[model samples]
Target: MTQEEEKKKQRTRNLVVGGILFALVILFYLITVVKMTGTGA
Candidate 1:
């Protein structure tokens, strides 16, 4: 692939990975909060 194409692919990969990580963090944070508060009864 050309240099430009390679750069674009790398950028896309980074964005996807970053998005997944952000989602995971948010999910974990929510889980922690729920655990701390406890379920109803």
Candidate 2:
């Protein structure tokens, strides 16, 4: 493959990994909030 194509592929992979990480963080945050409120109430 060409250098430009490799760079593009790397960028796309980075974006996908970043999105998955972001979603996981948000999921964990929501779960924690629910657990906290559930026990507090």
Candidate 3:
């Protein structure tokens, strides 16, 4: 593929990975908050 196409693909991959990482972080934070609250949220 061309250099520009390769860069675009890399950017897309990075965005997807970043999104998943953010989601995991949010899930972890929520789990911790629920545990602290003791409501089993």
Candidate 4:
């Protein structure tokens, strides 16, 4: 593949990975909040 095409592919892959990581972080944060607050002490 051409250099420009290769770079575009790499950028797209990076964005996908970053988005997945961001979603996981948000999911974990929400889970932690629920675990802490859902049940009263």
Instruction: Identify the candidate with maximal lDDT.
Output: 3
Model 1: lowest-lDDT 10 consecutive positions: 32-41
Clashes of each: 0, 0, 0, 0
lDDT of 2 by residue, 4-41 (tens): 99999999999999999999999999889989889735
lDDT of 1 by residue, 1-41 (tens): 89999999999999999999999999999888888899624
Better of 2 and 3 by lDDT: 3
TM-score of each: 0.91, 0.88, 0.89, 0.89
Of candidates 4 and 1, the better by TM-score: 1
Task: Tell me each candidate's RMSD, in Å, in order.
Answer: 1.7, 2.6, 1.2, 2.7
- The candidate that achieves the highest TM-score relative to the unseen native structure: 1
> Which of the predicted structures, 1 or 3, would earn the higher TM-score when compared with the native?
1
**lDDT of residue 13 for candidate 4:** 100
Off by over 4 Å in 1: none
Candidate 3: tens digits of C-alpha lDDT, residues 1-41: 99999999999999999999999999999999999999994
Which pairs of residues clash in candidate 1, taking residues 3 or more apart in a chain or in different chains?
Answer: none
Q: lDDT of candidate 1 vs native?
A: 0.93
lDDT scores in order: 0.93, 0.95, 0.97, 0.93
Cα TM-score of candidate 1: 0.91
Q: List residue ranges in candidate 4 displaced over 4 A.
A: 39-41
